[model samples]
Target: MSSVPEDRFRRSPVPLITHGARRTVLRADDGVRVEALYEPSPGGGTAGPAIVVAHGFTGSLDRPAVRRAAQVFRQYAAVITFSFRGHGGSGGRSTVGDREVLDLAAAVRWARSLGHGKVATVGFSMGGSVAVRHAALYGDGSGSAHGGRTEANTAAHADAVAAVSAPARWYYRGTAPMRRLHWVVTRPAGRLVGRVGLRTRIHPRDWDPVPLPPVEAAARLGTTPLLVVHGDRDPYFPLDHPRMLAGAAGDRGELWIEPGMGHAENAAAETLLTRIGAWLVAA
Candidate 1:
């Protein structure tokens, strides 16, 4: 796990084994190059379930926290981890949670291309919003949301989806963390900080037409099993966010409110991730 230059691997489409995973660059439907890692399950078969993991904003697939989650998930299924556009070795600037759906879509499609029969998407925080939106728009195989049954849409489908510590709506500035996050995405100085300090590249433009919120997206999941997990002690969005999502999903989704958990992948306990992996397998 020695640190190497990211430039050496960022643009290469060819797969190479690195740090115990198959690392490669995938071309997103929008032409953004997404850095990804594919790790087989312990049993070493591609026919079983596969999990595509989407890390939160400012989080990369190579981050220790994200990698840890992938490792734990691999116990139940093969895991595909990727950096969202503008994160890590990926190309393009982040539109925060808006256009990130395309990034998740690309990863999910790549998962199926790897020969995994069943695919589950697990996203944390900002990535959670992308997962929910991706599932609603493409998980049913119709891909009607993106206009038609294109390859990207077909590949974007997931059998199951899990969103952790995600917000229900956009432009929510109630919490201090969220307020600061908005500043990070909206201001030039903050964007510089994001690029230099966080190593996350952010797009300058705002959402042209606000994409569907997570709650609305949750309602459209259509038979795709959904799991909404949040922590009561979360510093960002509170229990109401998960409640709104779960409520919109109705019986199609299940909500787990962890007692002491704070937020996203960083705060997720090992037991919780293991349980989520089991849920993915059973769902």
Candidate 2:
């Protein structure tokens, strides 16, 4: 991979606040530029904790779905939302969910730097996979994804994690939606379509050593709290995914199988989002 431009990481003056939120650029330890937004809780409901939201594939912090989720989350606590690498204003090509862990770590660290005593992660679809892996790799002595660079950083670790509509293992082509998504990521012509039609950029290369799968990562979460949510109607992944995650999480995990829910953020209802917000507060 090519090195990111040095100017991408040059410190800028604090971002001008807009609509009660501050938008800024963050640099991952590996030098990827991650675009992030911080929104304080609207009222005095709760003041010390922050929830970092990670969006699914083809999603960006600028997308309406992400913005809506952030708005709902802020009702309970401060919210931090960001684009994963290769999405929106972020700097690198997407490695799908592999190296995206670094992007999430950067956002979590920023939430800590902002003085929030508690930080939790709520992720949708591909973001859910990233969230679980992040909690495992960044949690206290759980082991590191990037050598010792991201290890043992309590501030960077999420106190809790909620994975919604995520997959359990990689290379799952059992569903039509997932098969279509794979084509978009693996074929040159399909990648062109993703870039032109979907506004998503995918790296042509595959995982090197292959990071731990989401179920395995959930098992390694240790004392960290985990929530696995899936909908019976979700078209991408079946109920088996969430069940596997909850099983691996054992006593540390909670599973919620929604009745009519469909997929990720776009399909999530405001009521469900609020419930997720409540769960984070209680955590």
Candidate 3:
């Protein structure tokens, strides 16, 4: 499955901010395809830390918000923003956050292959959950449609991460929308979709898959500071998700809530990046 030709995200004016090698990282995940844009470090002075940005659901690599964040990160280290499999240049169906997590691992490996050792991961929405899951544990092969183990795929990261930013944590599942989607995928009347062997009830649908919860994922980190940012008015994850994560991690993580903004608002909300950028100062 190649990337859908039409992407709705608007391109940001990043030329004024970042200057580097403009290329693409066309990669695959266990024969399933995934890819990212490669902007090599400005390659001078002290480019100590590298970063890889992940996009949210239904979002392509060039999503407007991601490009803007990539532009912001370009000033610090190498920036690689990629599309999950089934979204852009990559192949396969979008597995919501489950399979997407593997895509992030692939991107991280690509960054490391470029000689970037100390890395920082930034993910938004579904991407955020993937980042947290990968940081906490190694490959579990949730990518398989058959739910088999990919144990041979060992952890690639050094665990010396700078920081992890998960803007919105869609933790709860009993919410109105999720319940409806769950019913759509599980109800006997919804058997038509099942006949095609399609299952829309993903982890985000009132269920979480990782062995470690988001808080455990953050606290599981040794020294790498984790930043948990969420919008109080977020309609998707609701308001309490980040609070729960920060509360769970205690000193292991930091939480910030954006008032009056809802889900996906962190990407487009006013002064959103400023706060996120400030919170990202390598701890």
Candidate 4:
């Protein structure tokens, strides 16, 4: 939890025409307030699609990596970066990826409210899982993993989705990073460290009904465009995760295994981000 350096990205007294940005707070379905940063597409309005960014575990809107991603996205399309509930200024505790869908839904709804006709969602790691579930449950007016569809499901949908470094299934402990992640989510002391040290708030224990896994959700995405990006060298989840997701997506999904990439947004390269932006725009 180090503060972002002031010199990281140059700031202006006013937002430049290349990337006009603003900040706001929106309420999730369950009444949790979610903090969000809205950056209009370069040159004022949405010349292309609007993008909603979902950060990884232990990340917030202010995180340097997240900010870098947002900055790159803004160059191509309008971007909305938000903190999932229990992270940053958002309220409530993290249900890990289960209840976090509500937060993504809220951001999507907010982006739509701003008059962006097309909305795309990009997520990293834990947020990537949330994005997939959100797209499945909310995109295309489909039913929830719990069972039948709800009104919320019918209303929130993303035109396209890109999940980077996301897990195909839950509770995976194969990799060292994932093993450490499990420790944080399962143990009380680990949760404390997450809250105080990483600024990540964890739920007490395991998911109750166990919301649908990302691969299952990807399978349900139907015609929605999906881009599954993972580094071949990723220390968490490995190639199987992205491959499973792409397989579930069938023809609607595309997979990109970076040659030297590591994990999540921190490992995503500028060229890759630009390519992702182009995909969303084309979608």
Candidate 5:
């Protein structure tokens, strides 16, 4: 993917979320930019913690599900959500779970650096991978996506908590057409992606056979309160995805199995909301 012209990403700021939502813009090296939405906490509360609601693969902060989750989380604490480059109103291309995880980290820094007490993350599908990597970074800091952080550690840290749905254990997914397509897309011909390194516009990379997936990293993330929610009828990842997620978290993870949910969508948003809110309180 070719880099977006400099002038393109420098456009006027856009409203972070609909309905008068406040906004923040974060810039990563190589001209990568992300949009963060900050919905002021209600009740005039100054010390409320923050929760980052991340979207799934091919998703952005503006996603209706993310927005709904953000609204739900806002009831408990301040909430932030954003778009990865090439996904929504942001810059650059997607890196599957690689470079975008770095973008997620940038968003995390923007939140925690503000002195928020507890930072919780709730992600769907690909976003779940982001929550996992973000949590892993809190304790050991050995994770990175896009071959930069290896950001596979899923379990999150003591101060950081995460909830993920339909997380793929092997980032590679290790199947036929998917693996072949992945290799074709991210072969990195000549080590200079159009002289690129994921910063060359909206490039996306699939799972590499190297290192560990986010689930594999869960074992090393210590005791970061984790919630694993998956629909038993998921068409793609299947119920095994949550089981894999739970296996990675071991005793530190919580599981919520929605009876008829499938794929990455919420079969019952109400049930998911109730369970997630309850989990945040328990943590």
Candidate 6:
């Protein structure tokens, strides 16, 4: 048997695909500039639907893991990937998941602007939480509990939503990873590390009025198709989180628990991604 080349595991020199990949900068509702990349499907414009990818915390569009996920998603539909504010070339500081909904909304609107009849959002971790809120707040052009209706919210709605490794409620410190994550978001020293070491600029404060929880948002999603995916071994959040989200989603939701998976895009297998792509296409 032959072993795979070491270089194969390293970052590839060539880009994913350049033919129909268009790069652009989108302006969030709050005026933050979000760097985004869009790739048309391999099957051309006839592709089923557009898939907008919302990356996890500390992740950027250029991250290899994100790019790899986009590569897989692009196989089924046009894919749009973007960096939330405070990550990569995007401007402004991260409000963690608070204001990140605007970032996901911007990306979804951009995907819709491409003339795609249907748009679906797939988010990981923090991005997953943002995706849920974005869908709940804008899915049916309805205003959120905390905010009034806006043109951006009306235009940014998604037809389908998928969240991977998302937390059901906030401020959870049950797990070591969640505890460390809280530290990073709450402490000055940890914020410094997040900004300098992780290249992620975390907000120095907490959510003011507190955005809707994932479970609450899931309950408001109505008929929008929702997929709640989580790993049994995920260290950041336990199985209860996904259970809560799935329960809130009720008839419009589906849950998938990977036996040995760890977390988010990094832990998602190619087969799983393929299934997700199929789901979006069917949606």
Error of 1 at 218 (Å): 0.4
Q: List the residue pairs that clash in candidate 1.
A: none
Per-residue lDDT of model 3, residues 139-181, tens digit only: 2323322234453233244232222234223434656645554
Clashing pairs in 3: 173-206, 234-262, 234-263
What's the residue-level lDDT of 110 in candidate 3? 70
RMSD of each: 5.6, 7.2, 6.7, 3.5, 8.0, 4.1
- For candidate 5, the lDDT comes to 0.60
Q: Which one wins on lDDT?
A: 1
Pick out the ten consecutive residues of candidate 5 with the lowest summed lDDT.
1-10
Off by over 4 Å in 6: 1-9, 12-17, 46-48, 143-151
Reference-based lDDT, each prediction: 0.86, 0.84, 0.56, 0.83, 0.60, 0.85
The deviation in Å at residue 87 for candidate 6 is: 0.8
Candidate 6, residues 1-283, lDDT tens digits: the string is 0011223324745375558788999998788999999988877683358999998888888876777788888878999999999998999998888898888888888887788879999999998999999999898786463267776567789999999989899888998877888888899999999999889988887788898898999999989999999989888889999999999999999999988878888777778988888888787
Candidate 5: regions farther than 4 A off: 1-20, 29-31, 141-158, 171-211, 265-268
Better of 1 and 6 by lDDT: 1
TM-score of each: 0.92, 0.91, 0.71, 0.90, 0.74, 0.93
Q: Candidate 5 at 227: error in angstroms?
A: 0.9
Tens-digit lDDT track for model 2 on 78-126? 8899999888989988888998988898898888788887899999999
Winner by TM-score between candidate 5 and candidate 4: 4
Compared with the true structure, the alpha-carbon lDDT of candidate 6 equals 0.85
Number of clashing pairs per prediction, in order = 0, 0, 3, 0, 14, 0
Per-residue lDDT of 197 in model 5: 36
Residues 92-170 of candidate 5 have per-residue lDDT tens digits of: 7766666566677666666666656566777677677766766675555443432333333322223555545545465
- Alpha carbon deviation, residue 6, candidate 3 (Å): 14
Query: On a 0 to 1 TM-score scale, where does candidate 6 land against the true structure?
Result: 0.93
In model 6, what are the clashing residue pairs, if there are any?
none
Please give the distance, in angstroms, between residue 207's alpha carbon in candidate 3 and its true position after superposition.
9.3
